[model samples]
Target: MKPAVLSGVHFITGDVACAEGALAAGCRFFGAYPITPATEIAEHIAGRLPEVGGTFIQMEDEIAAIASILGASSAGVKSMTATSGPGFSLMMENIGLAACTEIPCVIVDVQRAGPSTGLPTQGAQGDMMQARWGSHGDYKIIALSPISPQEIFYQTILAFNLSETYRVPVLIMTDEIIGHLSERVVIPDESEIKLVSRPRAKGRKDRFLPFEPGPNGVAPMAIAGEGYNIHVTGLTHNEKGYPDMTVECQKQMMARLTGKIQNNLDDIIKTEGYMLDDAEIIIISYGVSARTCHTAVDEARSQGIKAGLFRLITVWPFPEDQICRLAERAKALITVEINLGQIHLEVERCVKDKVPTYLVGHVGGTIITPERVIETIKEAT
Candidate 1:
């Protein structure tokens, strides 16, 4: 067999491709606790890293898993951790730490039914909001959703680039269905992809402030053991890593931490539209559920219904502006997900007054289907 081609590239499963993506993204450190649906990510990385002279550790728990990855990232290694919903919840505190300490790392959350282990092997999109605000505080995060295995591969690499460029933790917000689904994925050559490394302090090492804003608000991070003697902490710290509680210092730190992402959001956020120009009804979804919605919209279009599909590749820093534009012309918006009404609320918020938003959701172990979504769109249109 030669290889499967997509967009003229080869194919692979979302999970396996994710590991390959991480390796290609220059992730040298991986610390993760095994969990259902997402275990393949760790397994693949564990096997692949040794060949690339990288390191992979199966930590005792998700908390330690995330903490270790953050620590590695602080040491100036591109790092990652993979987990499902239950494990993802356990890593919240350290995730907050990564945010405050400005550690660049990637966290892959292959979501399953949640709220205390609702379903282990099943798929769910329940963690959509959690990815945005699971960790405490006001720090912003960037999250990417993959609807297919091929997308998973590409998005994982993009996740690392965004994290490094923004000096923040990036989340690959995948789901059980897509994680396990076997599909073809092409590995792009490095030259064809944009790779962003953390900016380095150019001069005056003695005067270097670890957290000081650079040209884009993201500070260049020097490795802890490096001659720069960089100090990192979770406390609200000033440029010198000393805890600063003054109103001005706090404001400046928060603004820079958030502004890095907000200011460059247009470059980070991505969405795909299908048959949108002629559609009266829009199907909005992300992650694994998006595939179903895409199929639904295609079927609806064939049935003479003006239905379009909007797939959210960047789930966080949500596509409010683009969504608002769609809402203006859309008669109705239908959101489909494996979890009950998680992303549906977001769609409602985006298109509230302009159009009615309908949710086609499933709970526990069930997966939403294209047929059901098409029916909902038909009724709405």
Candidate 2:
């Protein structure tokens, strides 16, 4: 019997769609602990993984959950895990380990309202900054935000592909609303979906250098027990994968770790612009907040305000170039998010006071209303 994919259009929550997307992306192992708003992802994968001859294990905690997935990926299996805010906090240290060791894995954080378990069932975009800089280091990571079930399905696959291609842990920074919202989703046929696998090391085992980057600045990985001596560690190391404690070694290691994502921003960044061609006022948003901006932009246009939307799909490389370009012509920019102006700071930095910028946001127990966004547009105009 084959693993059944409900291939046709069906109504499902974003978490379930995310699980199906991971399976389609060839994820063979799932290691996670149950958490609110994100539990559905693990539950779906737990039932389906076995059918596809894959593995699913519920770890004792979030720390163990991330650690298990890292070990599985080191053994050459495509792996993933799902969590909410608290669990995501626990996984930070190991997330850094994955970055340093150059492991390919996907970690999904279905964000909830919280500094510490504030609202387990409610949604928030508070984790936006944390997703990029939570792990206490000078490394770069790729993160994506999806507003609907269908988009999350597609983005999940893209997250896996990016993780494998860049040899870094990719994050899906969705919120509780999108994670639990039910909508029609279409799972593409396997032939139509593109998947990326990690590049393997070439040549004799003795000659292999695990940390030596290729022309693309990503080193080809060698799986454990694959006739290659692979040494992976969190400590700064040289090309041979041994611990090297020199200022020069630290500088070289850190540069490549950050450069792999920074230099390839063109490939890693994605955004969508609406009515931006001649707009004087632009609204910037991501995740569920972006959904409301669409309606707000339309309403603002009805009132003779040249309002536009700049929705972020790939949140992390920050879309600095696009934001900077938009600032030149737009009269003002308004950033709407669930948190208290987290991404607004980034928008301000990019604009550099070229255009007036304002933040319309809350502390996140509910969604931002389109009426408020439209009102902000009117005021800005």
| lDDT scores of the candidates, listed in order | 0.84, 0.93
Q: Per-residue lDDT of 1-381 in model 2, one digit per residue for the tens?
A: 465355778799999999999998999899989999899999999999998989999999999999999999999999999999999999999999999999999999999999999899999999989998999878888999998999999999999999999999999999899999999999877778888998889998899999999888999999999989788888999999999999999999998999999889999999999898888999999999999999999988898889999999999979999999999999999999999999999999999999999899999879999999988898898
Candidate number achieving the greatest lDDT relative to the actual structure: 2
Question: Which regions of candidate 1 fall more than 4 Å away from where they truly are?
Answer: 1-11
RMSD of 1: 3.0
lDDT of 1: 0.84
**Residue pairs with clashing backbones, model 1:** 10-185, 11-184, 11-185, 12-184, 12-185
Candidate 1 residue-wise lDDT, 1-381, digit = tens? 211111246555688888888887788899978999899999988977777777899999999999899888877789999999999999889888888888889999998887787788888888888888999989888999988888887888899999998888899988888888887677766667667788766677788888888888888888877778777778788889888879888888888888988898788899998888888998888877777877887788788898888889998988889899999988988888777787777788888678788989877476787889977987897
Count of backbone clashes, every candidate in sequence: 5, 0
Estimate candidate 2's alpha-carbon lDDT, on a 0 to 1 scale: 0.93
Cα lDDT for residue 19, model 1? 87
What C-alpha lDDT, on a 0 to 100 scale, does residue 166 get in candidate 2?
96
